[model samples]
Target: MTTDAVFDSPAVPGVPLPAFVQTLLWAGWPMEFLERAQERYGDVFHIHTLLFGKEVVLAHPEDVKEVFTGDPDQLRAGEANQPLEPLVGPRSVLLLDGPEHLRQRRLLLPPFHGERMLKYAAVMRETTAEDLARWPRGAVFSLHPHMQRVTLDIILRTIFGAEDPRDLTDLRAALSKVLDRLGSAFSTIATIPPLRFHLGGFSPWAIFQREMAAADKLVYARIAKRRAEGPREDVLSLLLSATDEEGKPLTDPELRDELMTLLVAGHETTATMLCWAFDLILSHPAVRDRLVEEVTGAEDPQRLPYLDAVLKEVLRMRPVIPAVGRRLSAPLTLRGRHYPTGTLLVPSSYLVHHNPEVYPDPKVFRPERFLDRKSDPYTFFPFGGGVRRCLGMAFAQFEMKVVLAEVFGRVKLKKARPGPAKVTVRVFTFAPEKGVEVVLEG
Candidate 1:
């Protein structure tokens, strides 16, 4: 639909703002915009923006459940996530639908299985400890960048299986460069058709292409090297050995794209959540003391209920990815209203997480609530829901627990800057404006 046509649509109700204006607001101030829109429009609303076009936002848990549990053939996440093709590649499981999606998902699932997490946990703890040792003492610094480094390092070792010092350093730098390029302002503008054209080497699209190419080159080289070697424990090794129903292993490009998907999907989201965890935890003395006590005293820190509750509360309050989208291919009715085929349905994780009906005193950070009760799948979906849910959910949460145990157990930290960290939109996810500044006191 054209930009002008979005304004005339009576099927969806939303803020009476122009597409350009809405896009600007969404790009600049997503949290405030979403909060205000939900307050005015209630649980359901629409956002007609230049970037996303018209997507109906569902804030109610029941509505979210219906869409999540709806027919995968009818509500397609792959089609809805088309814009990510440039970043993750066309062959990624994230971009595949129906049988193809299931096949790819099955091949990828084994690497992140519960047993495999035990192997990855060692990498996670070691990576966090190594990075924590490097953090400056008696000086204020942003923990966000540090968290990014640790998560990216963990992804490299655990996912890419990079063990050589030279290869690890090289791959880390290349991937970091690609992510930096992706987070640029011009990158968002490059999504628009008219502005997406590459003029020359220095052009925004050209620069992005170059960064991706560099990262892919390093990753492809690692894949080739790993292919020559025998089976190993890392995710890439399993993926290398994995064959579909036809007994055909993944091609080089397919491997590259899936690796890229894991990197893009796992890196920033987990890092941002870590930053928010520290931001939230440090601000609450009682929570911090309790968490530290549990982590420091526990025989196995990962099994502690309070630590898990703290992570859950952090995710509930600050979901890194606010919404998950599904595009309808068949007419469906939601909350008594009929939505036609081609409608975009977004389950707003941020809104549902903060809904007073679902979470009493939603604005407050209380880990005890989670300790007493388990959250409904539709209601607490930081990693999203249904078959399309993130493959790294288990890995990410496990890493969080391991890292939190390591951090709180070894060091004492205090927020360097007063007041809560302001939420800011960074590329596709929400992040702390100041990168969660803090200092080590001990």
Candidate 2:
């Protein structure tokens, strides 16, 4: 089908809301809006919103397949991620398109793959053990912040390779402040085009800029120090020494942007997913019992089938990123309907995971479903699909498995309530609303 075919095909139906109202709905409750849109308009529909101009959402497995397997030149994931520019910076791989994005991806892929990632497994285990040891037993606490701290430490030591305790401490504080600010309601408003204006240092945008500057200083210092100290095993050293096809090493700014992208993307999503996994496992006693038995007895905890299945089920049920978007650079046909260029196509992971036809009893948590059958990329892509899929998928999975194994084997945790934990959007990721309250048992 061609662009001409779009005229014959009816416009994709969606909620008819004014731009501002649509933005309000999106900013307030994105998942709810998507769910409602899916129920009312079917799998393929259009939504006109300020964020992406004109957008199309594809929820069914078939439509999502076309999207994932579409021509890379025609579907630009980087352009679709423009809203993240202010946070990850313009030079980040998440924002760059075409050849530059490919170059950066190639360079950044090695450390997160194969034996290199195996080296980080020890770091993940050690950090989780240390952090969990500090938790007060028999006291009610939110596991979210604890998971965040552990994951942050893992990223710092394994990826950034901050050797100095002082540097690590400083960087942690700055990053925490920046992330907290980003998660605020005012920061969400600051992302809007008209509100992006700076009103001196007091404005939310200005404050964010200041925090970014502080973070940049520490990151640059670390980069410079790593450069002078020669090669090391961490991801930073790998990136510094890496070259493009022309054998050109990454520049300081390029390194900084890539590092920041990894720092944010690497830890935040994993931490949030970890919180969800902990809550899910604790809430389901049978699953918890099975997991503990599997983890404790296994020689290689990472190889435990049930633990892996449990993690997969958690991701399927509660994908940290609800949808992965792509803006069409060329007219395309999706779900037998032609769409014009400049249309934003989003593959809703949330909708796809909960599709009753594909997953029977979708609301119920069942890890055994994974063992029964393997999921195709188009059907079960929590890290996304196609060429732009998340580079840290392996590393994140490994970290999750290792951390869960270590924690479950050592500490006994109990849920504070019998009900499921509430979900909330914390910045870009879905997080537990009350932070997954639990008590460490004696």
Candidate 3:
């Protein structure tokens, strides 16, 4: 409990498997591993894995607070996220550290803020409405892909400023292909370093590079056009006009990396969260009735408190990104255990959310808990915390609320199958298995 007491404690208990075996298990069922480890080792443990060498898992709120609130100098998040470099690019904010990270974050923060976010809300509602209008009523269908399409449309329109019909179509097609390939191949490349090697065009890494190049071509073209034409309402235009403290403009490659980061992170996680929300709401009919009533009665659904609670509960029960990783840049003490500089400290969001000390009856799907009490950031963070907290947290949360309100208010829906939906791994996100099958009701 106290850092002094844990300072001399042994390194967190864990399985001592070879890196390859650990990688195999982690890729398949990381949540299961974390759950079992917590049950066996209490709140703190370790997983000696190749993904990031010796990774320690922390679940206690106190430990989480230390990790989130720790000095940026002592904990290097960018180095911890090195595996993501290939996908997000070297200049991505996700892969930057220290002063450079702060710079990129400041430059990117404006477009996702107040007035600009209001404009994006309009896009979110319109895009969701357009997508939902095409769904076959009174028929069972997988909801994940539907949610993905809507979120992708919103991102394309707001982030890339893809207004031309041809440009939108071409970029969407190219990005979709790239995403599909990445979804399948990223886990392998991320877990196994050797597999990331490029062996000509037929190799998976080579194929991924080709797909990214195709997507990049469209992105760079848009960047050039936006530069030539001047500023617009989209994020790309805003970034094009932005200048640092020294008045230095972002370069082409810098713009590409930032745009790619936004494109991928902006849509995918929101889509997964939406799918899980649908699955959770439909699984509990009473909750669904109350949510629908709240959404329908409110002139502005985003103002409905119960609806907000439901969203919070969904995120708590099943965070899209279950853990946030950090590597120690200096010797540090957590839960009384001293960790070396290279130690990989992963704060497990899934375990912390489920901790009974934090939430009584944690397994139960109860939104009222949120209504009754607020949770501290360290205990309930789904978007992570500290300087490395997700930059689009506000944007993602607003989009989910708007989209859910639009969908639930307009249509009656039910789960296609009985019992709780199975959870599965999709890329790095925990998704509702079977794509959260649901039937529309008249």
Candidate models: Cα lDDT each: 0.88, 0.84, 0.83
Structure candidate 3, residue pairs in collision: 6-336, 6-337, 7-336
Q: Residue 191 in candidate 1 has what lDDT?
A: 57
Ten contiguous residues with the weakest lDDT in model 1: 2-11
- Largest lDDT belongs to which candidate? 1
lDDT leaderboard ranking: 1, 2, 3
Model 1 whole-model lDDT (C-alpha atoms) = 0.88
Candidates' RMSD to native: 1.8, 2.4, 3.1
Q: Candidate 3: what lDDT?
A: 0.83
Assess the local accuracy of residue 6 in candidate 2 as a C-alpha lDDT between 0 and 100: 39
Q: lDDT tens digits, residues 93-188, model 1?
A: 999999989989989999987767988877888899999989999999999889999999999999999988899999999999877656767777
Candidate 2 or 1, higher TM-score: 1
Best candidate according to TM-score: 1
Q: Candidates ranked by TM-score, best first?
A: 1, 2, 3
lDDT of 2 by residue, 1-442 (tens): 4433332356677777887787677767777887898898888776666655666777889888888888877898999888777778888999877888899889888888866777887788888988987998888898888888988888898988976789779989998787766567776777766787788768778877888899999999999999999888799999998998999988999999998899878888888899999988998999999999989856676778899899999999999998888888888776557778877788988889989988899889999999768888987989998888999999899999999999899889998887677777776777777788999888
